[model samples]
Structures are given as C-alpha cells and as structure tokens.
Target chain A: MPGVLDLVGIFVFAVSGALAAVQKRLDVVGMVVLAEITALGGGILRDLVIGAVPPVAFTSVSYVVVPLLASALVFFWHPHFTRIMPAVMLFDAAGLGLFCVTGAIKALDYHLSPLHAVLLGVITAVGGGILRDMMSGQIPSVLYDRQLYALPALVGATVATALWQQPQLHGVFVSAGSALLAFGLRVAAMRWNWRTPRARGVGD
Target chain B: MPGVLDLVGIFVFAVSGALAAVQKRLDVVGMVVLAEITALGGGILRDLVIGAVPPVAFTSVSYVVVPLLASALVFFWHPHFTRIMPAVMLFDAAGLGLFCVTGAIKALDYHLSPLHAVLLGVITAVGGGILRDMMSGQIPSVLYDRQLYALPALVGATVATALWQQPQLHGVFVSAGSALLAFGLRVAAMRWNWRTPRARGVGD
Candidate 1:
C-alpha cells in the first residue's frame, strides 16, 4: 500500500494539474495527461537524475490510475471543485512539504552528496508545477508569483539533508520534522501573501 | 572528443535557446541556463530513462562551454544573428535530424525495444525546444504551429530504429540514411511552407 502521505501528495498535485487543464480549456484527454504529468513529473525527474531505471511512476499501476481518476473527478465536477480552490492550494502546500522531505531522503539513499540531495528534494517538490505551468503557456509560477514557494521547499530539503548527516538521527523523525517546517512556512506564506524579492530594476 | 555531428547539433540548439532567452529579455545568466538546457535537456532525459547516470553533458566541459559561447554570441550580436534567423533554423533542422537518428541508436545500444528507441529519438530531437518555449512563456511551437516539426524527427527516428534491426546494415549507414531523410523533409517543409493537420476542433 502506498503511504498515506504519498497518496495525499498525489491527490493535491493531481488536482493542481486538473485546474491547469480547465484553465486552458483543454479536453478530457488533456486534463488527464496534464494531471498525470503534474502529479508524477517531479518524482520521475528525480528518479531519472538519480539513475533509477524506468522510474517507480512507470512501474506502478496505481500511481498512474490515481492521477487519472483525480483528473476525471475534476473534469466532471469542476463547478464544485473550483469552489474550494483556496483549500486545495493549502493541500498542495502540504504535498510540497511531504515531497521535499521524502525526495531528500531518497536521494541520500542513492548516495548523492548532501547538496545534490537537497537540490533533488526541492526539484521533487516544485518541478512538476513548473512543467505544468510551462506546458500551459504561462511563466512558471515559482519564478513569477510573489510567493516564497521554492524557497520553502529549499529550506525543508536543506533541513532534511542536514539532519540526515547526523549519525544518531532517525530518518522518520528527520522527514516528519522537515515536512512540518516546510508545510508551516508554505501555509504562512499563503496566508500572509508573502512575496519573494525580485532582481532590482528587473521589476517583475 | 565529441563527434562532429554532436558539436554541430549542440551549436544550433544552443543558438535556439539563446534566441528564446533574448526574446524573453532575460539576463546573461538566464541566457546561459536556457541555452544549456535547450542544448542538453533532451539527451539528459534520454540518458536518465536509459539508466545512464551522470549524463555525458555534465561530464563534458566542452558540451557545457559550447552552449555558453553560443548564448554569449547571441547576446552581444543580436542584430547580426536575428538577420540570419532563417539560416540558423535550417541548421537547426539539420541538428534535429542528427539528434533523432543518433538518439535512437543510443537507445538501441541499451537494448530498448525499437518502438521505445524511436520514441526516445523523437524526444531527443524536440524536447529541448519544448522546454525553451515553455520557459519563454509561449506555447511550444511544435504543438502550436502547423509545421511538420516533430513529424520529421519521428520519421528519422523510426527509420533509424528499423534499420538497426537489420543485421546486415551498419549502424553508421543507418544513421546517415535517417538523418538525410529527416533533414531533407524538414528543409522541404520549410521551403514549401508545409503544415501538419491540426485536431478538427482545436482550430489552429
């Protein structure tokens, strides 16, 4: 069975994908494709970078099915679904936290350096959304939006990596602590409408 | 030393990436990043899927430097470069042809099925451009434009994969033939302003 955290993360990511498809006014096939890609793209990217063959995403049937089902649900009930966009975004933040921490641990298992592991972790949290936004013909939200999105993931990943380096640290505790930090930061940023600084004079 | 064909392909792809960065009014750092990604993203994607770790692009200083040079050239000499945009695109077609054929051959070396090899080949040809377009906040030209961009690459990759299946055919000859077919088709498509059919209701 997939972990509860993993399923929750997938659900939120899938919903974000569905939202992009609806925003684009794409068809049913497009919705499913976008959802699957958005939900799984980050993990697939991490696996590839870490040299994991065929990736778990391709090897597991449920991984593929869950996202498609989420897309389908969104497609048929968009009116009710979009109404909860704010709550959904909050869940997405939580998913981001979970993914970043887990991704860092996985990279460490593969013997990546702490720096590379943290980078991979951040990628696992945010890469899918970048892919989705780009595919939808918009600037990547992480780059363009006035939110401290990517930074929170980076912070969480860094925390996870640092904790893992301690010989006495339990991996589960590291993961849980990292996730909580990231999740708290993301939720706070959203609630406060926090903005990351733009390059001076570039004026984004 | 990298093959002559590989260098030429990288040069053209780098130019295309730099063009995107310039259009987006991004800084020098952005130009280099975009160029590197455009020149190497497809091959990296292929390598990852094939379980090739520490992708060749990362290992080779030349591959990294060449694209940076191309981007710098474009940044300082935009007027001269843009004036020759048509010629640059022709070279890009040649590069596309080379990458698809070579990419398929590489996939075959890893014992992938012919179908997967061919798919990887096409991906290796066009994936970078998709990334570039997405980063530039535009719809991918391959998906948005009616031109036979991806089709030519698909034809070349399929040809390469099929020829590799023949015991009597030398891999070099197979690559040459595939590249020629794709390059010829792309040039013809450009000269004649040929187009692929769009989905009926998509209404391009």
Candidate 2:
C-alpha cells in the first residue's frame, strides 16, 4: 500500500539524516531531531499548504517511531552505516520518486492548481533534505549549481500529475511509473555526473 | 488592532531577512524568498501545529507583498538598511514579544496544553530567524549556547497562557502586559550581554 511505501521512504531519509549528524559531530539529541525533521519535514510542509490538519506524520505514531529507530541504529553503529552510503542514496532516490507522486496527488486532491500541485510535489521531495542541510549549517545541496536533484523530482511529479488526468490509467500504475522514472533519472544523474550550470561569475 | 501590529512585526522580520540575503550576495529571487520565509515562517509553523488550515501567510496577499517590498527596498539600498540594524533589532525584539503572546493565545484557543502552548509561543517568536539563518548557511543564533533569545519568549508566552486561563483578567491587558514583559526582558538582555550557560567542555 502507499502508506507502507511512505514509511519505507521515511526510514531511508531518516538514516541519511542520522549520517549527516554523525558527520557534523552533533549530540545524540541532535541526531534524533535531525532524523525526525528529514523524514517528516517535507510531508508536514505539504500537508500544511494543502490544509491537511494534524499532518499524517504528526497524527501517526508509526511515522515518529520509524525515524527514531533509524536514528538510534545510526547512533549505535554509524561507522557501519556510513559504509553503505551508496545503497542509502539509491533508496533516497526511490523515496524522492514516491514522495513526488504522492505529494502531487495529495495537492490535487486539495484542489490546488496543476502548477501549484507540481511545485508542492517537488517541495515534498526536496524540502526535508533542505531542512536537514540547513540544520547542519550548510547551504542546501538542492541550491548548489552542480546539483541535479530537484529537476528529476519535478519531472517525475509532472509525469505523474499528467498521468493522473488520464481516465484510462490506473492510479497505482501512474504512481509506480512516476516513481520509477524519477528513481532511474536520479541514478543516471549520479552515474553520469550531471550538473546544472552556475550563474556566470557567481562562484568557483 | 492586533492584526496591524502583526503586520508591523512581519515587516521588521522581513527587513532583517532581506539584510541577511544582502550579506549572502543572493540574487533578488533569493532575497525575496528569504524575506518571505523570515517574516512568515514562525506563524506558519505555529498555525500548522495548531491545525489552522491554509496558514494566513499563504492566504493573505499583504503577507506576501510586504516581504517582497522589503526585499526590494533592501536589494536596492542595503547600506542604509545595514546602518539601521540596531533599530531593526530593537523592533525585532518587540515583534518577538508580540508574536509569543499571540501565538500562545492561539494555541490555547486550539485546546493545546499550557506547556505546548508556551513552546509554540517561543517557536513562533524565534523560528523565523532560525529559518533565515539556515537558509543563509549559518548556524541559528538560537542554537548558540550564550544566546538568551528564546528564554524571554518562553517567559512571555507562559505569562500570557496563564492569564488566559484566568477568568478575571481582561484579555487585551493580558496580551499587552505579556508583550511588554518580554520586550523589557529582551532589551535588558541585549543591554547587559546576558548569557546562558553552555554545556561543560562544549566549544567556545
């Protein structure tokens, strides 16, 4: 079910956040806080914009528990965890894909414009990571000129949203296809060193 | 009216955010985004947690426009704005006082516990600045061990929430008095260089 996939996504994001904490040398409390934020921040932002009260992350104990568990795991064995960074990034890409489709659907359900819904989907995919980076005192990776993160999310969300408007397409199929597209694109971008052009004379 | 005062507070916060953007050498778009976030981030967080739908920041045109205007003003003449930084900080403290009381009252109205209401109050006062700092790639001033920013907000919010629970006190008086107390405390802290104790052996 979509709910189960969402949890999986949350878990992956939480692990990434915990790793970021390890890198920053933050306290145990900081690790847990960062994990929670990285897992739930985007969903919370999406729900708030679309008027979903007591956001799913807030209302569901399972959502809170999963991220905390991820944090605890990383806290106890971060060295081992860091060794699996490549695997984590792949899962993070899947989460990004799933969130974009789901977030777009949710926004449309709330009667937002197609453009707005797409934007919200991208936000739901990238907002958490942005918050995580900012909390760790770094410029968000999404803002980096060389990062191709948000673009793929935007593409996947657009595809899903468009598919959603087609009467013949099943909802689950639409979501699955969108997720796969985004995940594959992200993986490709990583493998190929895809980069965005920086503003002229901006930085080295 | 309280609404008018809230706008003033927002304007001051937006100016501060714009100044931060100027320092960061962000483009006009960045300045506008930071301004909007800094002015409205706290209220948006408070509203989302309290289940206030379609946060006022998203709904109101003035809320959006005021910050954009502030960003424009600062983008063009940052030198003048920077010279008035002290005056802006004083107003920012007052705004913090007002927001803490208002945010607490709103949370209580939504049936949150006193403790949660007070926490929301402090968040509403400081969350914007924290977001602004993070967006600009800096550790939040609130997280600094020696900063006394949030404590005064906590105190004011607690006072307001307690007064709200009492049937005898006039609501307007309670709000005004709470704001005054917080404003006085913040001003005094600034004047005296009041410091909070850091964890032993933490970085200086």
Candidate 3:
C-alpha cells in the first residue's frame, strides 16, 4: 500500500514538472527530463544521504514508468491540466504529505536521530521541486513561495516521528494520520493564502 | 597527499562561491552558506552516490573549517581578490583538475565501472559550481558556459581512469599527469576562447 502511494505521489509530481517545462517552452526531451527529475530526484537525494545507494528510484521499474506516463499525459493534455490547477495543487500537497512521512520513517529505520529524520523528511518532500526550479533558471519556490510548503512537511515529519516512537501505535494508522495532517495543512494554507513573512528591509 | 589536495580544491571552490555571493550582494549568512555548499556539495554528492555514509564533508573538521575560513577571507578582501581574477581562474582550473582525478579514484575504489567512475569524476568537478549558480538564480554554467568547462573534466577523468586500469603505472605519476592535462586543457580553452557549439536552431 505504501509503495502504491509512493508511485501515485511521483506521478503527480511528474505532471507538475511537465507543466513547468511547457510554461518554459522547453522541447519534448526537456519536458521528460524535468518530469523524471521531479518525480525521482527527492527520493534519490534522500536515499543517498542515508547511504541507501542504488536508491529505490533506480531499482524500481514502476517508479520510472509512472513518471514517464505522467509526463506523456501532461504533454498531450496540458490545457486541461491548467484548467484543473486546484486539483493538481491538492494532489501535490498529498504528495508532500506522503513523502514526508515515508522519508522520516526510512531515516528512522537507518537509526538516525528523530531530529535528523525530520530534517531528511522535509528535504525528501521538497528537494525535487527545488531541483526542478533551479533547472528552469529560477529561485526555488520552497525558498520564496509565501505558501507554507516546507512548514507542513516539517510538521508531518515531526508527527510521524513522534508517533513511531510510541510503544503501541499502529504503523498504518500513524502513517495515514501524519500524511492527512500535512495534506490538510497544505490545503488550508493555499485556500487561505497563508503567507510567510519576508525579512524586513530586504528589497526584492 | 591526496587528502591535502582535496582540501585545497575545496578551499578554492569555497572562495569562488563566496565571490559569487558578493556579486549577488547576499548578506554574510548567505555568503557562508553558499561557500560551504560550493566547497562541500560535490564531494558530499559523490560520497552519497557511492554509498559512503556520513560523507567526509560531514565527518572531517578540516573540510568544514576550510570553507568557513575561505568565506571569511572573501568577505573581507573581495576587492583585492576580484582584481586578481585571472589568477583565480587559473587556480579554479587547477582545483577542477585535482577534483576530477580524486573523485574518479574514489569512485573506482567503490568498484564502480570505469565509465561510471569517470562520470562521477566530472560531476564532482563541476557540481559545486552548478549548485552555486542555481542558488544564485542562474542557469548552471556547466550547461551553458561557452568555454568548455565540463569537457576538460571529462578528459581528465577519462585519462585518470584509463591510467588506473594499466597494470604497470605508478599511482602518483598517473594522478599528477591526469591533473596537469586537465589544467592545461582548461587554460588553453580559456586562452583560445574555445566553445562548445550550441544547437543550430536553439535560440538563446
């Protein structure tokens, strides 16, 4: 079930990446490349930092195939996608929620401290989008987006780690609750236009 | 000796990163962060890919301290440093040369294929600058620089790999020769304004 959720998250991320490529007027190859990087880059980065070489993204054919399919769908139907931007944003939030919980859990499995696990989880959730923006010659949205993206991931990771440390919590329930909490927070932030404050006296 | 060479490369890379921060007019905190990322990012990336857990950048005091020291120097003496830009470029080339050989050798130690090792080598040589560019909101120079940057690293990595495969070669001589070759190629390319051709139909 977790594996299936991961694939679904990757697909949504890939679609978003492909849309970015379209907006940038990139060619077909660029769209696919961006999609793959958006889908797999975060997991790859998390895995590498934790010494999980030959990361699951590299080993799983499904991980590769799902993103390619998502990219293709977006490439052929981006106008429809643009119209459904709200739905897409919802799915992206879900992806963030799922990734943070799973990334934190994986770090715990490697015996990392809870604090470090939380950090890794946030990185895993945001790293792909960061890479995508960088490749597109823009500042990373996570760094500059007024929306509370990384904060939600941090909260989700913290909750997940806390639950995991409990002596009697059911794993499935813990994961689901943490992910839903993050998803809810992200959705609320978007709906309410929750914005982080910029530094004082800093001119853009 | 190789350890010392790696530190030297890191220090130079960190200085370049700090210089970039100055150009961008980033604050001191940003300067230090950029410098650390530039000096250690490539090696951390290389170590992660090769399953070297707790990367040397995280483990070694020197690796952390050198970049901090470099950042401080750049922050205080940037005007003088900028005036000697040509010499700095030469040093950057030498750093590139050293890193490519060392990175490839490390990858080879992990028993990666020679081809994979060479690729890692080039990545290690250029990855820090790429990160610095991306953080500064520019396209990675490796992707767009006209004056043949990655190519020289490629040549150096390939030479080092091939020589390492030879049964009768001395390790020290092979490393020195490969580094010199890469350094010389980079210098020549800059002197002659050698450029990799852009796609004919691609508009800048």
Q: Highest DockQ: which candidate?
A: 2
Q: Write the per-residue lDDT of candidate 2 for residues B1-204, one digit (tens) a residue.
A: 988889888999999988876667665545666788899999989988887866677566677778978877786677887788889889999899999999999899899999999999999999999988878887787898476789999999999998888868846888999998999899899999998987888756
List runs of model 1 lying over 4 Å from the truth: A197-200, B1-36, B39-43, B54-130, B139-204
Candidate 2: where are CA atoms >4 Å away? Answer: A1-44, A48-105, A111-122, A135-137, A143-204, B145-147, B168-170, B199-204
Model 3 interface CAPRI class: incorrect
Residue-wise C-alpha lDDT for candidate 3, range A1-204, written one tens digit per residue: 988899989999999899999999999998999999998888888887888878999899999999889888988999999999989999999999999999988988887777767767887898899889888988667755557888899899999999899758848899989999999999999999886543222334
DockQ, all models: 0.15, 0.17, 0.16
lDDT by residue for model 1 over B68-98, one digit each (tens)?
A: 7897788677667789989998999999999
For B1-204, candidate 3 gives per-residue lDDT tens digits of 878888889999999988887777665555665787788888888988897885776456688789889987886778878899899899899999998988998999899999999999998999899888888898787897788889999999999999888757738889989998999999999999998988997855
Q: List lDDT for all candidates, in order.
A: 0.84, 0.85, 0.86
Candidate 2 recovers a fraction of native contacts equal to: 0.26
Report the number of backbone clashes for model 2.
0
Worst 10-residue lDDT window for candidate 1 chain B reads: B24-33
Which pairs clash (backbone N, Cα, C closer than 3 Å) in model 3? none
Give the clashing pairs for model 1: none
Candidate 1 lDDT: 0.84
